[model samples]
Target: MNRHHHKPRLVNLLDDFAFGGVSRGLGIFSSQIVADAADCSVVAVRPDALIAPRLDADIIVVHFPPNWRRIAFLLSLRVRNPQARIMHVEHSYTRAWEALKVEQKGRFRLMLRIALRLVDQVVCVSCGQADWLREVAQLPWHKVDVIYPHAENPGLCTLPLPDFSCERPLVIGAYGRFHEQKGLENLIGAHRAGALPGTELVIGGFGPMEDELRQLAGNSPDIRFAGKIDDVAGFLRGCDLVAVPSRWEAYGQVACEAREAGRPILVAPVDGLPEQVGSAGLVIDFTNPDALARAFATLDNQRLGVMARAARRSAQDCGLDRQREWARLIRRLVPRQARPIGVPVTA
Candidate 1:
């Protein structure tokens, strides 16, 4: 078993703030895989991008401007390290295409298509995302693989479920970037409909909609905007239930994370979120605020406990070990010649 032969040089390309669940999950999984079997590095498109501290130090970090120069930088690096395998952890094809259109010149779209073909594999965070890559970006299905990201190591939390002490205030918490796709407006409407006797809504994150959301929550003592907390697990631990009323989702990583943390999740029956939540959480209609309000009203401590237990059990199937296995399967699908040669085998 040649140790040096086992190491595959790998590069991951991320566009911006790696704090989101998808980015964080990919970073954790990639770091662990690289630490155990391969040599890996991460490249942030923006120079001053904020990244998770959990990323392995051995995974070299690089930054480049999100212009034509970024592509040029990647090309130069590829030339210098011809053996390296490049994996684009695509968060959003829409953003990628937008970047290509704005930054590059001279058949930029064509160049992007060609550049995508050059890579051994393009791993999409969800099946919807993979489809988007193929349909919108014109990437071939054979080149795309769906690998739903996993939660960070769940062992960090030690808090036992709080004794069903609160009067079950019909509490609901939504976590994600404050964007149009999140359906925060719908959630607010649902909250206003007198969903429960004592309803409280807590939203966590920061975005352009922050001011609008704040204004909407005005004088509503029942609603609180926590504004981008560092410890999501802590918040999850305290919440009775979680809601993800997304209009569209490539993959709802927060739903998966909440489930892993043993919290019942209520998500819009859209995209890959329902698949991720499985039977553990309620998947309701995204368009109907009244339906969402009714769903929240039905949530109780006993029901939450049952759902949480099921969620935790189901989450085991989507953990880091499952991700590692998927990575191995993807690697096996790659051409043997393209893989690192003479690698030592280990379980």
Candidate 2:
């Protein structure tokens, strides 16, 4: 940076600033994390999909996953920003996802390995994800650092916990895109098996699987769809518990939000979810037909109250120092820029 603009330039390169956790993570990083330490900004690489001649930055944080087609682009990015420290934050692709979705595992791994070589450092969003990268992908552990999806959602954090003393039918809420990856089929199946008696399932959000999910519900009075939710905290507050049955989630933002809202969560032990859930909520193998219902069958007002308090405490624990992590990482990786102390004194 020039003497006039002395702060280090921390720029985020995003494939799409459209939606989803990856985009939201960039928003959080820009507003909360990097703003305090550097001159922060974002470049949406997907909108116009142009590779500029020069991207002026001292530290470039990448927010998108790499692919075979993007390999050339990544090489170009590295070549262009030779002076900057480029860090690729891998926000997608766990081994579980590759197992379920990718047909050619060997080829895919090669692509990832190639892409990773172009960046100076690799950042994973969760510890579990980082572990998988080191173990399965055979990436060097020295180059990997995990930074979980975190933010200050004051609305959810400040919300009053549900009054668990009320003897009412349990309300379990599900939110997010209606995708096969989310595995709502497992949750719907658990409810339909009559395993979840006297329980209500409220789902929100929209996607291609909307019709399939609704059809699976099949006129069940207990299962309802609230459509696309604008007020997430309000939606979370209405429920006694939140369920995330994702088959493969690298890191679950929904689970985090539920905890922040002072509501306990039920998550499948998939990818990084168990790590995020910690002791604050229930971790069941949603793939097991009877597992979810069995957990739900045991919940009483007393246990729910205990879990709610734990959820609040867990949320508090998560919010600690996430804002400062980026600054620390920049300091660790990027060379310090000399700042002007003042005009030199002429003797």
Candidate 3:
């Protein structure tokens, strides 16, 4: 129950291995952690969950769903590796989310409390999310920490910046489930209302809202769905701008990816999206269709080029702080003997 004096083995746990932002972020973190410590691995609860292949080969992986079997497994782990520090990143909940699901609040809070008892820390991806964890979820403030997910995409970083001066309709890329939370409906409405004429909207993702979204678009040639995409870097490369019009976002990885790709982004002024966008992209109140359209209509080649370059510079300035932060945290968990020197924290 107490923090170990020696370098402790670290085990990161997640509810699924699905190819979502959280999974990718954890995969990258696990890989980085293993490079610094001899014993670091990840455990995905579902055996059939789709995991990121990029996870380091040496990092051990375990699969067990949350049940009595998992409790027994954790008990075994606690016994076998007494000094091991286990941490769980709560990727799915927010204070706003709790407000929306009033009936489930009691059970959700209980689950969070019980889950926290099993781990050394509860990592939230954004400051706003940390606030929700500590205040709304009633997690001990000390147990919650904000660790922003890395925005750098290796594939996108390696690609050359596309020609922004080309004579073509400016492409606006948006990737997320066609859900109300994502504000994609608002985006479609703004487009359909002729706010962003002479431009194309390319959406890359699938969900329950797909049918409804398509119905909203209603034979609009300017709107195209690329289905679920695997290569986000390639997708960004084809676009002049990226959009993150979420009603609420813990951390907008798409905004980061857009910045990393040096493409200007238009993000809803909410939560982590604004924090990520900074001065590099336009932040509009997507809830109002007119405001969203006006923001889109103002984009010109000159402004787009300037913002794109700013985005790249912003991402560069942030550096790989996530690695260093992880290193510092992991060092505190275990003794000096287990901590490797110069673990190459950079990706």
Candidate 4:
């Protein structure tokens, strides 16, 4: 039980537990935040593929059906745990909108509006997302708080550092969902223009743009696609540097994760990425392929080491402790309330 303050019982609402950076960060924070007085529960909209086995015994897991039954399930939860503070962690607009769309006509939207209104606090992982909740979803900005995701140094314990000391092939790694927003196509163009010798580009992760990116990589021996990696830290550890060429990012979790893994990162100055990168990594204008290529050419082992150290230092600032502080603030602002039995917290 967290003893720093009177920890409030919290129910975290998540869409699913997929193997993404956002999910991983939420899992880590949830587990650590409730270490003292706070009792925690996780309600997944659907069955979770990646379960956090380290969750405390007091933490309950409830999986609801994908359809309309979710409302009834949540209603029952409120009846059972009237004192629990509901924390809806919005990860995607698609999932949140879909859930909101379930009610007939505009009533669903109204219900969703009312539902979030009941929450003690709504947490959005990125500022862009917080904006979306306010503008697109019509959630009040005052109720929605931006809690940037955090990552811990994996250290040399689980993942061993690869021998990147040689003046060998310069490995440039780009990781993320293979979607249009990732800007992988632009990165490919930059790599082609740069045409730097002894440079190898490896893109990791799977998404809709797999075929497009694969074709763009061509049959060139210098470029390779490693596909989706289960152990991101290990993959980053083996690479010389990481790149985030996102067109628009709510929060570039890849950049933060790479930093936490003690790897140098090059990111497009998009959304919260620049704020996330700070002075820790290189920020490039992704619109210009020639400039991106030139930036890639300049990256050497010595430069990588300096950036890696800075990245680690930056990551430390957004660790589990920082998240707990946010949690404390949320608790203080909202306090606790009593609700009717069997009535949904949102309703």
- Once superposed on the true structure, which residue ranges of model 2 sit more than 4 Å away at CA? 1-5, 47-53, 151-154, 317-320, 338-347
RMSD of each: 6.7, 4.1, 6.9, 7.3
Candidate 1 residue-wise lDDT, 51-94, digit = tens: 22222221222322223445555555445444444455565544
- lDDT tens digits by residue: candidate 4, 194-248: 6445778888889998999888878878888887777777678677668888777
Candidates' TM-scores? 0.73, 0.92, 0.78, 0.70
The candidates, ranked best first by TM-score, are 2, 3, 1, 4
Model 1: pairs clashing at backbone N, Cα or C within 3 Å? none
Q: Candidate 1 — worst ten consecutive residues by lDDT sum? A: 56-65
How far is 325's C-alpha from truth in model 4 (Å)?
A: 3.0
lDDT of 1: 0.62
- Which candidate achieves the best lDDT against the true structure? 2
Candidate 1 Cα errors over 4 Å, as ranges: 1-6, 15-18, 29-34, 44-82, 94-115, 137-140, 151-166, 297-302, 326-347
**Which of candidates 3 and 4 is the stronger one according to lDDT?**
3
Model 3 deviation from native, Cα RMSD in Å: 6.9
lDDT of 3 at 18: 70
TM-score of 2: 0.92
